[model samples]
Target: MACGEIITEPLMVAAIDLGTTFSSYAFATRGEFKDDPTKISSYAWCTGSQPGLSLKTPTCILFDKVQNFFAFGAEAEDKYTELAQGGGPHTLVLL
Candidate 1:
């Protein structure tokens, strides 16, 4: 495939936007796009800082004391906040 050429394959396309403060992902299948070019599917993140639904989630990662994966996105923020309030040791990585 050439850089300037359009892809003619019938497949699903996904994209991730990893921003400094927030992150989001969107996807669409070829058939879906054909039906509605402006239609795309994305997840709604429920963050602690913000009420209701949000398009993007906080770009944060939480790990256990042993460096194991704990949570991501809004869950990560909530967990980290809990740990901090309870004076628990945890590793938080902000992306």
Candidate 2:
């Protein structure tokens, strides 16, 4: 492997999208892709304020006062909201 070089090996492929308002991840095995390129699999996120399932979750990160990672995605949104309502100490980063 070298800079700007492409690898042609057959391996599982995964991707993550961190958007301004949302984030998501998906993956597919090489065989699965060979069968159908559109058959990638992704997780469904559940939010307290939203109905049904969401393929993407809010792009947020929660950290404690010490700056240690605590939660991410929908969990981060929920926890940060809870802390805000209760006036608890926490750090929230929205990407």
Candidate 3:
């Protein structure tokens, strides 16, 4: 680091998977060049769930064409379940 250099705060960021019918995130951050006893930069920068854990989170969002908003995650799943239980005219479509 340069003398009197302003060290910016570290942060985590990610982009979601928009086309796979699910949400996803990708990210990056500065890497350490020297080994230090304490203070290591965050290894995983962007991911849906948590990076480096073999897990990823999807960024899929579902909407009601008529309602014009969104019913996300388990909420969307529950809506499907409700339609099933009542044997309504609901159908599943991927966007």
Query: Which candidate wins on lDDT?
Result: 1
Q: What is the lDDT of candidate 2?
A: 0.81
- Which segments of candidate 2 are over 4 A away from where they belong? 1-7, 88-95
Which residue pairs overlap in candidate 1's backbone? none
Candidates by TM-score, descending order: 1, 2, 3
Q: Write the per-residue lDDT of candidate 3 for residues 31-54, one digit (tens) a residue.
A: 332233243333222332233332
TM-score of each: 0.78, 0.75, 0.35
Candidate 1 per-residue lDDT over residues 7-71, each given as its tens digit: 76858999999998899999999999999999999998886666789989888888776777888
lDDT of the candidates, in the order given: 0.83, 0.81, 0.46
TM-score of 1: 0.78
Tens digits of per-residue lDDT, candidate 2, 1-95, equal: 68988878758989999898888999999989889988999998897466778899888887776777888888887777777788865466433
Better of 1 and 2 by TM-score: 1
- Model 1 lDDT on a 0 to 1 scale: 0.83
